[model samples]
Each structure stands twice: as C-alpha cells, then as structure tokens.
Target chain A: MATTACFMIVSRNDIPIYEAEVGTAPKKEDAAHQHQFILHAALDIVQDLAWTTSAMFLKAIDRFNDLAVSVYFIHTRLMLLHDSRNDDGIKTFFQEVHELYIKILLNPLYLPGSRITSSQFDTKVRALARKYL
Target chain B: MAPVAPRSGDVIFASVERVNAELFTLTYGAIVRQLITDLEEVEEVNKQLDQMGYNIGIRLIDEFLAKSNVSRCVDFKETAEVIAKVGFKMFLGVTASVTNWDAEGTCCSLILEDNPLVDFVELPDTCQGLYYCNILSGVVRGALEMVSMKTEVTWLRDMLRGDDAFELQVKLLKQVPEEYPYKDDE
Candidate 1:
C-alpha cells in the first residue's frame, strides 16, 4: 500500500522542531515532499482544533484520501500523517515520543523553539516508529 | 558524649525540604536560557553559571555540615567519597562513582551515571565550546575552598557531549593550613 508514516514535532510557537519519515514501505522523493507539504498545511487546522478541547490526543483530525492526521499536543504538537487507522499504536507512539521530547526540553543547553538536531534523538524516534507504528 | 556517626545522605535527604523535580528542572532551564540571552556569549554564560554555583556552594556547605552531621576537615580521599556518596545524594538524590585517582591521591574523577541537572539537555553545535555542566565544577571547587582545600575541578566528560556519563576531574592543588569556619565561636 506504499504506507506513509511521516511524523513531526512542532513547538508551541508554530515552528517545526523535529520531523521523521517513518514509512514502512519505500517512498519516492516527490511523495515525501508532498507529504511534508500536506503536514504543514494541516498545522492551521491543528491549532484551531487544539484549544477546542482539553484532550491531548485528537485522532484522525483531518484526512486527505488515504492519509490521516493524528495530533497529540502538550506544549508541542506531535502530528503524524499516516495511511492506516491503528488508533492504539498511534497513541502509544505519541506518548513515548512525548517522554523523549520532554527529555529534550529539560536540557539547560537546549534553547526552546529551536530545531532539534540530535542524531540520537532522531535514531530513537525512528526505532520507536518501527516498534509502535 | 560519644562523637556522633555521620548521617547517611538518604536519612538527611528525607529530612530536607525538597521541591518538585520538574519545577526545579524547568526553573533551572529558564535561568540558563536567561543567562545565555543576557550574556550573548556561551563562554560568558558558562562563567556566570559557575560563579552562581560557587556562591551557592559556599553557603550550602554550612547547611550540609549541620544536616549531615559530618565533621569538617575530613582528608581529601574521604572528602571525595562523602561528596560522591552523601553530598550529591542529599541534594540531587543521585550517587556518583569516584574513579581514576592519581597515586599521590591528589586527583580523582567523580563519575555520575545520572545527573539531575541534565535531564533534558542536548547541546547545540554553536554551544560546543561551552561546558553545560560547568557550574558543578565550580560548586565542588567552592565547597572545598571553605574547608581549606585548594582544588581545581574540570569536566572530564559530559553526557550532553555524547560521553557515556558525567565525569568531573577534581585535582587537589594545595592544602591551605586549617582556617576558620570558627570565627564566631569565640
């Protein structure tokens, strides 16, 4: 099905801090670009939907054909654009990544709202992606 | 009265007023952020943090002594052990391993597998020259100074810098002749 599991962490101020393309199947360069474009386009919708409820997880908020957008917000918005509808796996992935994100945030050296550029963090997120997503 | 045995860090920590870890962590993060912004240079910020830690260390030694029931003037070897086993545990709730001592017993490394001050930190490339945990070195230096041990402390390894653990190399420079924390006793 050429599955797409592109995940992003956007800071509260609407800056993209971390992004990972964790698709199970191989994806084309153009498809990856288009996926990011769609993900960014959905951020506006996410902001609007975030304040409407106190809940952190908004499952499958906005969908475009086979692509589904799931968001988990806590100071930073964790958005995943995936092709499947596994709510449990997506939620688990979000929660685990949140823990990792907090570790990044807790660093006295890390400036808030800056791009997250750690290879270790990237590698762990990819591994978690394989495990849960 | 028989001399009292020194209290364990766990016992002293249990009696101390401790704040929420997250609150403390975030507050420290904010302070560091403010320091960087105000200083505009990572090196300056590092120095400022060390200075702040030095001030805190000097004052903290009094509370540490009164609470831990550890007598002043322990030898360098015992001082390092107490710092690793009791001092860190009392304040940060984590124990450090003391290793890599010189034969003369003038130097050693305090290895911390877990550092409470460094939970959420990843150093950006711009700040590579900065020692994120420099304050810790200053604290050790300042604390030792009060007890008449002239020492130098440096970061041997930092977990933030991709090291396996946090290690501080503390070197005894020269032992000053016994001084007074006893000025008021007369």
Candidate 2:
C-alpha cells in the first residue's frame, strides 16, 4: 500500500541505531540503552510526517490528500516499534515530541508547503536528523 | 488526572474569517493549471506529502504535550483510547470511539461522531473507496507503534458514503520488532 511505502521511509532510518547497538563502540548496548534512540527516531518520523502532509495539503485540493497524509503518519508510528520497550520513559519521550511539534506549528513564518526554510525549523530538524543519522 | 480540553484553534473550520474550502480549491486548481502543466509523479507527490506530514506531526505533537500534558500509552488499548480522544480532538476536533471491541481488544471499529474534513464536500464517484481525510490513522499507527504497539489500519467503510457515519477497523497486529535485541530474554 502507498501508506506502507511512506512509513517505510521512516522506519528504515532506525536500522542504524540497531547497528550502533551491535557495534563495539562506546555506545554499548545495555538492557534498555537503545530505548532512547528508538523513541527519538519515532519522534523524528512523526514530526517529519506531520510537516510533509501539512505542506501537501496546502499545495492543492486533492480528494486523496488526507489519505496520503494519514498513510505516511501511520508508517512513521509503525517504524517506532523497533526500539520501543513499552516503558514509561518511551511515553514521556513521546509527550516531549508532541510538545515540540505544537511549538513548530505555532510559528507564523513556517507556512505549509513552503521550503521550511526557517533557521529554527532547520536547526531543530537538523538536530533530530543528525541524532538519528 | 483531569481530562484536557482541546484549544479553540485546533479544530478544523474553527476560523470563519479564513478562506473556505470551495474557494480554496478553485484557487488551487487555477494555480496548478498555470504553474505546472504536467503534474509530477504520484510517488514523488506522495513522498513530498509524507515529508510534509512528518513536519506537521512534529509540531502538532508538541502542542499536544503542552496542552494535554498526558504521558504515553502503556498498551495498545491505552494507545488507541488516547489517540482517538486526545489526539483527534487536539488536531481535527473529532473524537472517534471504538465501538464493538473484539475479544482481545485488538479488533475494533472506530466511530467518528463529527468530522470537519468532510463537512461540505460530497464523495463523488471518483473518491468513494478513498479515505477522505483520515491521515491521522497513519500518524496514530506510526506514532503509537513507536511506543510499542504493532498496528494495522484498514477502512471498513469510507467516510464519503450513503450512511451519515463512517467506520474504520484497526487490527492490532502483534508485538513489534520480530528480532529485537531483548528477544532472547522474552
């Protein structure tokens, strides 16, 4: 399904954290160490999907715009399962992610479908992307 | 412990001063026609849309946390409840409830009491089987799945239909990550 495809783009990004866990590097894999990485990745995906869909909805009037957006959102959630431990910490992390998104939406300059050219937007997105990347 | 009320601005059509959908659609059509004669690829368009949705989800979740102040859901049922009530209310001004919950609470039907996205438009023959404006399903599925619920969202009935109501069936597929690092312990 198109929805599945859109979500895959988000879930695939987590493969690295798993790789990081496997590596003998400094970030050793403790019992729940990977939890944060997984949660952050999911948070990033949610924000990304929301921004992208809002942009598309603004671009045109299509019958399937909502559906398309929904698919992408679902995919981002699906991708988050890889690192979640069903713990309280994960829940709190999502709450924080939710708060971050609301802040972004409140800003006036970052209109839907625009380039998201705001320095603040770029900085926040870059921070998340860099962490996940 | 107290339930959080949704803000005034989050609801769709909450702003009467803003442009209406009909007028907006007309303007959008004219603009698209003038700008790009050949539309881009559907995949490319959807990709762009996903990216946009990603951004919106980020910002929307931020507002949700600040306003609702609710923490995450511990299980699938909790996640579904939170999403249907808090998530939908904050974003779309609708509260979808799960009626006829199955044995495991995995198979459930969503009933939308009020929807703003389909307020004015009729589902023409072209858009029948399509989900009119339920991108939240993807967002919910993806967002909650990240919290640990493996969810599969399917439409039992499209929103644009003869009945005054719409139903979406959500099946909780299974636990996520077939081969998680902690699988051996479980």
Q: How far is candidate 1 from the true structure (C-alpha RMSD, Å)?
A: 3.7
The alpha-carbon deviation from the true structure for residue A43 of candidate 1, after best TM-score superposition, in angstroms, is 3.9
- Tens digits of lDDT, candidate 2, A1-133: 0111111122333322111121122443473544344344345445555665653111111122222111123222322232222234333333443454444333322222222223443355334332332
Residue B23 C-alpha lDDT in model 1: 83
- Candidate 1 local distance difference test against the native: 0.84
DockQ of each: 0.63, 0.01
**TM-score attained by model 2:** 0.40
Clashing pairs in 1: A103-B120, A106-B120, A107-B120, A107-B121
Shift of residue B40 alpha carbon in model 2, Å: 10
Runs off by more than 4 Å, candidate 2: A1-133, B1-63, B177-186
Span of 10 residues, lowest total lDDT, candidate 2 chain B: B28-37
Query: What does candidate 2's lDDT look like per residue over B1-186, in tens digits?
Result: 755433233443243235554455444333322222233343333333334444455556655566565765556676667667767765655688867689887878777866655543443332234344345455655554554567666556654556667676778888766456666658
Candidate 1 lDDT tens digits, B54-169: 98888888888888877654578888988988899898888898999999999999999998777666777777877777878888888888888889889989887888999999
Q: Give the top-scoring candidate (DockQ).
A: 1
